[model samples]
Target: MPVRFGRIAARMFLPKKHNPRLAVLLMIVATAFIAATTLFAKALGGDTLGPPLHPFQISHGRFVFAFIAIASAVAATRPQLTRPHWGLHFARTFFGWGGVTLMFASVAFIPLADATAIVFLNPVFGMILAIPLLGEKVGRIRWSAAAIALTGALLLLRPTPESFQIASLLALAAAMIMGVEIIFIKKLSGREAPIQVLLINNFLGVLIASVAVLAVWQMPTAAQWAVLIALGICMALAQACFVNAMARADASFVAPFSYGTLIFATLYDIAFFAQIPDWITLTGAGIILSGGLLLAWREARLRQLP
Candidate 1:
């Protein structure tokens, strides 16, 4: 297992070539794995399993298992996560952990589709963050796109009697943090290997979750144990596939497939929770995606500039 994982890590760090078709295929599949990870997490925390776990405990277990997998991979491959960026790494992981903390809890309260869609607004947040973080310029068109995206979020947030959910708010909060986290990743990906970044991210998650999880931890039953393990495995695979996909393609090329998360989330919701998003959610999600696509087009154009 260690040897096999080592090879995976090695490939992650030093890809000789980029394959667009393969990258897209891998990303599409990775999104499905990510969707499965969320499903497992929701099951671990939901009433369907009886005696819901604490969000921190779930995070703790996730990082713990992910660490085991990643460590084993690195142990054999020996990818050194050395040479600086300590502050940025810490900042990125801090926000990344916060997103995990909130998103996990939010799933307990909201439908999967709504939570995932709210989180999907990360690109818009990324555009906003890029000015300071990446020194990237956004023209009027992109800023206008942001306004339309905000309107979409507001529409989803309309306080209808049966449709409004506080959990959706939590998810949005997580999504915003995730946006900042992605900006950090954009910086890091240029300087560090994917394995190194993932290792540090999970390592910090373990340390933070260990302390937080203690206050609310509960012993996992056998079935929950299996699901949690599956969650770890699924997430590790998803992360690996995602990093590889991004490494092989430009952000604009990969951005659209990221929306596959919505389809997978909706499918899982129907299969497990028997829920479907209402018109408001669909409409709002459409608007948000429109803005995100616009942002991607703008980014591609910027990259093409001489």
Candidate 2:
């Protein structure tokens, strides 16, 4: 029954033909949705919305509502699905949930722009992890990119004793865990339908978060509840758009546009939170984005070679 539902959803949502222009548009939209999730997370993590929710509780809400959203789509479309690789799904969900929880933890103490910039380090971490886990070779160009991105992350850390923020470490840790999640995502990429993967991943995330959040469970204020739902729906939409974009165009083409998330995150911070980034935040984000773009170009070049 579930498998049949997933197939219908995939047909309904997946692009029928390649559309590079549409793909770029979708990537941009996905970035906005992704950034919106963080904005909601920041709101729920802080006292302005209500009593601050613990990171676990925030993440739990993310999974629960996201699952509901995805499940509803599955039922509506009724797509058929292949059996999932449960082990891979479990590992992916574990790291994904952990990364989001840590990211939420950091936003409570730091600006959204700063936190979003640091999270970009995930691709670099994924590159490093690929070396050991996937037996993939990393050449000097990729290494250089990693170095540049790390330098940007360090600048964001504001290592000076007076200005240093301990909460930033949580964001750093989130990037590392999310990097591992990327590795799993790569493994699953060609193995299952994107809709199926998303459904199972969210389902597993809900189970894990439900267990972890039990210890820190607290009732959220009405506003927090609304923000949580918005966060989840935004995330579900982001995932759907991102997968569809990748299907429509080369990842190298679509991936760079994803940096749009940083821009949107900053704008949201300014519009709602009135947080203006200093030169450091702007410069660090640019440096990191440059490194990420360099790496993407390198991958494109490599793909062309063969």
Give the whole-model CA lDDT for all candidates, comma-separated.
Answer: 0.80, 0.89
Candidate 1: tens digits of C-alpha lDDT, residues 1-306: 656765665565556367888789889988998888778778888867768998888878788878777776778777666675877888888888888778888887777777777787777888899899799888998998788778788887767887677777888898899899988877776787778878888888788889888889888988888788777767777888888888788767886888888789889999988888788878988888788777778878888889
Please provide, for model 2 over 1-306, each residue's C-alpha lDDT reduced to its tens digit, 9 standing for 90 to 100: 434433444454654588899899989999999989888888888889889899999889889887887887777776789988899999999999999999989988899999999999999999899999999999999999999999999999999999999999999999999999999998998898777888999999999999999999999999989899888878888888888888898887888999999999999999989999999999989899999888888878887885
> What's the CA RMSD for each of the models?
2.1, 2.7
The 10-residue segment of model 2 with minimum total lDDT is 1-10
Error of 2 at 223 (Å): 1.4
Top candidate, metric TM-score = 2
RMSD of candidate 1 to the true fold?
Answer: 2.1
Candidate 1 accuracy as TM-score: 0.92
